[model samples]
Target: MFYKEIFSFIAIAITLAAFIPYIREIFRGTIRPHIFSWVIWGVTTLLIFVAQLEDHGGVGTWPIGVSASITIFIAYLAFIKRADVTITCGDWLFFIAALLSLPLWYWTSDPLWAVILLTAIDVAGFGPTVRKAYQFPYSESLLFFALFTLRNVLVMLALENLTLTTLLFPAVMLVLCILMMAMIAYRRRVLFA
Candidate 1:
């Protein structure tokens, strides 16, 4: 129990550490996050937090709740600041797909199914960000994602229930963040080369 609390706190700290810089960069107009991605992540993350709580996620879910709030704020900022408003057809497809998935999750009876649906949507939500990052490699923050990857691991470790619903999102996000960082690095090198 003590270890869970500690892990949760540390994970929460890392969430703030990661997002603070990304938020700072957004205000500085250095990092232009995709609005679609943020909205999907924010909504799904919040829903996942709720699912985790019901599934006995304990203190670990706190960071996810915190992240969801921050993510929604970032989405608002992205919309208002007009950061990367270049919406392509594919971007619209991703956005639309995310919207469509919401109903599926909402109708889901099982927490696991809801988490799975939301998690998949959250992952697919990466489309616009990945697309944008590929085109403008330096526009995204590598360090933020690195911290996120670590945070997800801590989140998993902090989980009290250890159920599939409780662990799946962070587990998947852990992999996604690593892959995202790798893709960004490759894009940076290729573009710079």
Candidate 2:
């Protein structure tokens, strides 16, 4: 148990370390290299593997990894190529905020509080990105929002102890889906009109 715990902690640390510099560049208004971004994401996927292998939550890991990998790849293809739409200061702020919540997630004994806090941070952090994605639907930025919403929903459901706040996460996800669909419809009408 001790070794597994330590390894889990180390894996988390490595992921965060790889993520920090990319995040710093986002603050400086520079997009990370697609390859570098992929590395970070790959590491994250691996983290999920370790988490599950250690029995932290095995079945849930696969969906999270698949969603994240697809989202990252699509996001890279869509936005990383455009200099003007590269990572911005707001993006970094949100990224860091989300990452900061992970330690809290690991440490908290109360699963309900952890879920609530993590869900809130994720949604809030992703808000700016989601707005930007909506404005530029053709860009890969849109993929992350979809993935983010999915991830939140899946994680909430995966929790063994279903809490009241878990319901809130899915409700929020439903609203996001509705809002995104509405935005797409509005944009299409505007363009065609």
Per-residue CA lDDT of candidate 1, range 19-69, in tens? 998999999999999999999999999999999998889998999999999
What lDDT would each prediction earn against the true structure? 0.94, 0.47
Pairs that collide in candidate 2 are none
The list of candidate 1 runs beyond 4 A from truth reads none
- lDDT score for residue 75 of model 1: 94
Give lDDT: candidate 1, residue 66: 94
Give the per-residue lDDT digits (tens) of candidate 2, residues 61-166.
3444454455365346435554334566666666666566557656756545554565565455445545554556443223333444555455444544333533
Number of backbone collisions per candidate = 0, 0
Candidate 2 RMSD to the real structure: 10.4
TM-score per prediction, in order, is: 0.98, 0.48
